[model samples]
Target: MAKDFAAMEDSNRSSNPSIHDVSDPARRTVLRGGLGLAVTGLLAPLGAGTLAGCATAGGTAPPLLGFKGVPVSTADAVTVPEGYVTQVIAAWGEPVGVAGAMPAFRFDAGNTAAEQALQLGMHHDGLHYYPLDGSRRGLLVMNHEYTDDGLLHPDGMKTWGAEKVRKAQAAHGVSVIEIEWKDGRWQQVRPSRHARRITAATPCAFSGPAAGHALLRTAADPAGRIVLGTLNNCASGKTPWGTYLTCEENFAFYFKGPERPDAHQRRWGLRPGDPVGYRWHEFDERFDASKHPNEPNRFGWVVEIDPLDPTMTPVKRTALGRAAHEGATVATTKDGRAVVYMGEDARFEYIYKFVTRDRIRPGGFAANHELLDHGTLYVARFDADGSGRWLPLVHGQGPLTAAAGFADQGEVLVKTRQASDLLGATKMDRPEWIDVDRDGWVYCTLTNNSSRGGAGQPAVDAANPRANNTMGHIIRWKEDGDFDGTTFRWNHFVLAGDPANDRADAKGNVNGDAFACPDGLWVDARGVLWIQTDMSTSAMGKGDLARLGNNQMLAADPKSGEVRRFLVGPVGCEITGATATPDGRTMFINIQHPGETPSERSDPDQPRRISNWPDFRADGRPRSATVVIRKADGGVIGT
Candidate 1:
């Protein structure tokens, strides 16, 4: 479930499913029944005072640095507009999981759950910062989607050895860290109640319609009473009532299923499709597609966790349905309903939104927890003319008719792919991240998919128009009347890649496009779209166009369609996991797998420093840390 952009573009595996990768089981474009998410993979200070109204004349505001939409020079470090500084917060191996400080990290030594519990997990992805009661301190919850087998074990991990495999398992899961700003530097509060880790060994429960469905039943969970753990957590969100929502991505590879059952050979579920990729079955019998046809049903759903209270077991809210759930971003509706926008993350998959029934009572814990349980889940059906509609997935609703084979709510959730198919939701080119700006516009990143369905593959439509979409794009739309409704207006904002490349502007979408593999996404307080890239070509050391080498984080002025690359990661790295302080004076961005390449990567202190990052840190370890960017005056960021 974990791979860099190179695997996304080059490897046939569905890790990222560039265009053609979707149609086959081995490929990512297809959804893994119950597996985990293909855990996925940025910075910059924003400028001055709520520069009320549009960007001042020169893309800059009075008394503040004008944006000018000018591109930053390609350098080997982080960049900020002006008067801003960034600091590293944590790295992959720094202590956190245990009761006290972590021992010197041994890439080769054996670390048990107790030892690993104190250290940070691998491939840090989406995160949440929960302000603590009466204190400037907050809880930082992060997802360690998967492990870097080579980096975790002394010798590369061999699946055959339970000891090595356990270490690898110990590395997979979530890490909750306690962080507070002291003397202006964010430091960990060692021995704090807020710091903790949740791994594959952690027990979790399933909720919603499919909680006890037949597909989820396993030998370990004969009655489907429990799910052992949550794997490959990618993008995530925070509940209005203060819980954290972490998603499971690329979950299929974890299980070693048997052969493809007769049903699979006929036609795969909901995935637009995949033709080739990893033969995970070769590794373990659990991966056998035939024996556990229903195994995949257990995963690929949005999970909810309460970080403040670490012991408050996490849950998979299947009410949101399952697919390659990129992540869910929750917002309130005009009527006070909690609306969560989610992306399926597979080419041809659908974009969905779940509007809760109970109104979020703002700071109302009891109300918010119940808000997600009951909601109307809708899929997007966009038209070529830019107008769109939401197709309902309610049991027995418009498209959830008996003819579709989804006669009950559980079926709708377990077979979300089929439910969406019946609704005819607009097919996309690998939609990955979804966010809602304060302005109410919904933005999504359709990460690159080299295969445009093909002769039989879905063609480029208005919503997704590009045959071989090597240069991915970000698209946005406003709900009808600028409200989150059933219908909306849409437009392609930016096409990605080298500005000089002719194909970059294939559909006039490249106006502000300067990077590829637009994966992780978020909207700042200023309405500026923050985009981070996952470039496989760069990770592989191939040609520059595909291998820009340095994946960057860009800020886009949506109204003007202007964009800029404000930060670039180290060698062999992809920028990801970004969040801004409420004050906007400081912003936190994650640098994951700095040097993780398709062939190999370097260790923490030795050979092939695959990536030399978080360089600005006072400590020279160059670990993957959360970089906090702040303006000197502590003024609002990105005016």
Candidate 2:
């Protein structure tokens, strides 16, 4: 659903019918047995019953819910296993905070910027459930990836006024809602003190070596340490210290107006005009690069928020090295040091890891508040032989010196892509999300690369072999020893596509559970990997891609290389953001931007409405919401 430079460039070129073409031999070799064997070997150490609550009454773990996977569905409802039930917990415009008189979501009317800020933000993406006392009551922290202005405002973005723009800004950050499981259902706790919303207008602080860098200074905040808010929060993770790590993604589109173009703006894809059509410059001068050039630099970093303490301001952890960060998953070494794996979600972007200089302090949030502030950031370089190395971005480490335009570590992190270029890191296909298994294997989702094998694009390599990769794949690797090590072995777990389509990954899609564009990913408590799809809007329900049906979630057994479709989302939506209870009984997933079907004509008077999911009314507008799923027999999910 998120488009970048590749999408814009492809749209401008002459329509090439061969863009999605896949050679038969290439498709057959996409998911080689060697790759699957490598992944299976790495995951084999995770014996059965490793996942909590997975064992049956006889003390043997049941075979994963291979319950004849759900069929491809085009219906306007969430389709899960035969016994599972789904209910909408919270939706957009539902009041969250302690504000008086909580209002019900209105389909026809629009909420004010202040009201929207107090409600659940739009387009819920990556989410995690933190149990306050190891039970049902906990905080649900999630990211509002982006906004759909057409549905947010009464007249749409075409006639957006300052108020509409402000409301849009108020809907783009993160939401922390208090939820509880009661009477066999999960529901939101309205007006709970823990229920708070952090919008783009909220104040945030910078931490780490790059905190006070000159590149981050802005007219509004000359100190360079204080930023107004976070933007484009896509995928997220929870830390060992109990804080939430929300990643900023696709933030370049929010800024415009640099009188003269520079390397920083060009590298980040910021152009002269509004590319994705959010003309924030029209309302705030800070959005104009010419007026506040350094403002954009403050974003694109991993933001840390302490959800337990609502009064505490979020921190932009600059030590993580900034980019279009899709998400950052944290793992700890035996020595208790924090190791975070992050992916830059853009075509030809590189994956990165950050290892803390000090081990995490035992005393919880207050004692380990600044653990992330001191970490060595490293970019990954994959080799053709299935081995890889981590290249540190420290200034003067190798070619990163004054001659290379990096004076200090702060500068290297501020321009992380340039540093990675100097280090010759492998350019990957839109790396979206990363999750670590109980066996310490790291998995990353490469969400397709349409530009591969094109005239001017990067040639296919062993890691990314497909020419025009319409269907995405997942790449996994193991650290040399543990999470803190540098080198590792890697392989592709699955190359996703339509099973009936001969051009797709036939071997991987043998069971007819064809899926494309793997995006949001999570490794649950039991070591089962859950993958969510984000098929392009233009490809969904059409041609070869249509056979896969709507975007869906799948459960995969890493050790056995067995994948089964778990749930199919409603029409015109991407199924993403998954988390489960500690006992692994109930699972929560976010269905983002449902019913987002685009119109073929440019008729403003008669806008096309494809679906109204969750609240299926012919006249109702579709709103993104969190879906809570549970088994009818109260058994562990996926088993």
Candidate 3:
């Protein structure tokens, strides 16, 4: 969720009434009934055994492994199905091609900023495997979402030096490494020319109409055409032309107070006097909004990187608009135009989409490089009846005009959250990662809203039916006709919670493998949707959520709404970022921030570690790592 620093403020002092708490009693009753029916319809196929023998698009049965799920675990090691095997490919602090041959990782000492820039970052989030020759060997591009100051520095953020600040910055970007499936095992191809790292210090270029806009201009780049780095890169996506799209999320917390902060900055949760902990402004004047003012504006856009070309500088496509962007997933229009869908991970924020004007040209990556530069950005609005419309964010059209403080189209893209507010877009719970299936149905994870059901938060609605949605849910929608159309029909795919608490379906039935806080999501080529969890630290292993055990990965058949627990992570870790091989044999998942308990995050003095997963070091330091899973029988995974 947008629960970085700004979300912390909301949970602490916000008093606005929930938008979902309607005054109309009849409407509320109708919505409640509709939600129950939606859940029933979504899972109806599962009860009838329709999904038991479903086939992929290629007319072959999906490899669901048929291995019953391992029980929910709180162990200090990863738990997988009986017949599956997992191996750690890479972990934080490991060398990833700095020079020709990278040095070994040293966990005992603090790494310099230069060394960090060359190593795999701290928290591994979203990732993708791009096959080089259609299979086996490929480039793995992953996002280093954020940093853990408590672990990065022994003394923590309260006593950080200049080098410590820089090291943290270097550890907050993306990493690309070359790997291959050799002898039935996945291993990194060390020192390969294809391996590279993009850190917060790496230089980047800007594209699209908002590239050189006034709001983006900085002292370093007066022309506003270039930027220094990309920060808080969360989930990611791959383009049809072979490139990685890394999203800059929760960026507002990185910079200090703005010179002349406005409602826009406040709406994004960047307020003065807030102890962001990183305190980057103390070392780098550019991070201080008061000095550079516009530096924060340069980040928080969908950045595209070509992993195949190691020399290529990442480009921040500004036409996609800016916010706490979780990520962007793309699908082609019937006419071949590219459409990208994204979600702003904030409470009451809106989901967005961008449609390129020109059709995707067939050929090399250079030929279609500028496709995202020219497009119409839109925000979604779902009606109570399950129908929705995409409202275009064009100046002088509707409420996005001079009267609304927007000068032109550029302003609309830069201050997208403001434009969304002016257009009266529906305030959702917290929309996170989104994925589009082969059938063009889009699935989004609304990762919980603790502020809901309270007197000053958004109330229950048809789409977000729960008052205090502690466990979060998934919603799916199909466009009215095609990817380019504005109208669509949507419904709830799953309402995640603890099944033992009488959290039954519409027919009073519950599954044994219940989960909460759906975050990372991916759909394999075999049509099996992979769902990951990120439970709140305070709620983990407590109450209804405790019964669900640690965060885990679940496989769901979208056609039947049947979900099965596939794997569970160690204590105090979130199971996220998943991708499977073309044949669905090798699957990669990210285990982030293990051993970071609620007490460790809040009470630094009396810190307690929960786990030291991946490497169960006796020193009590945990490292985030990526694990590769393949069936022992060499069959397609998740069968």
How well is each residue in 1-639 modelled by candidate 1, as lDDT tens digits?
135322232212222222222222221121121111111110112233333543556665443323423243334466555566677777777777445566655543455645665688777888767777323577788887666555565444333355555555567678888888899788877877777788766788888777788777887688775787777788888777888888887775555444343332222331222212322344433445455566667778888888877667888888888877777888877776788999877656778888786677866454466567787788887665456788888888786867867768888887776667656677777788888766666788888766664644565555665677766777777787524588876665566656555553332334443567788898876666788887662333554354354677877665455666677766566678878666555677887776665554443223234445655332233345577777677666654
Pick out the ten consecutive residues of candidate 3 with the lowest summed lDDT: 28-37
Predicted candidate 2 versus true structure: per-residue lDDT over 1-639, tens digit per residue: 354434542322222122122222232233343144222343334443356555668987678544558998988889998888889977888887555746666676367887788888988988998998565788899999887777787667557568987898888888898888877778788778887789888999999999999899877888898999888898998998898999998887788847665766777776666645676788877888877788889899999998988898999999999998998999999998999999988877789999999999877789988899997999988766566789899999999998989988899999998888778787778899999887777899998887867776666765676778878788988889878788988878777775556663322442335678899899887778888998866777576677788889988877666678889998888888998878887889998888765442112322237768777777677778999888888777776
Q: Which model is ahead, 2 or 3, in terms of lDDT? A: 2
- Candidate 3 at residue 262, lDDT? 72
Model 3 ranges off by over 4 Å: 1-6, 9-65, 98-101, 258-260, 502-512, 599-608
Q: Deviation in angstroms for 302 in model 2? A: 0.6
**What TM-score would you give candidate 2 relative to the actual structure?**
0.93
| Residue-level error in angstroms, candidate 1, position 134 | 7.9
Using lDDT as the measure, the top candidate is 2
Compute the lDDT for candidate 1.
0.64
Among all windows of 10 consecutive residues in model 2, the one with the lowest summed lDDT is: 11-20
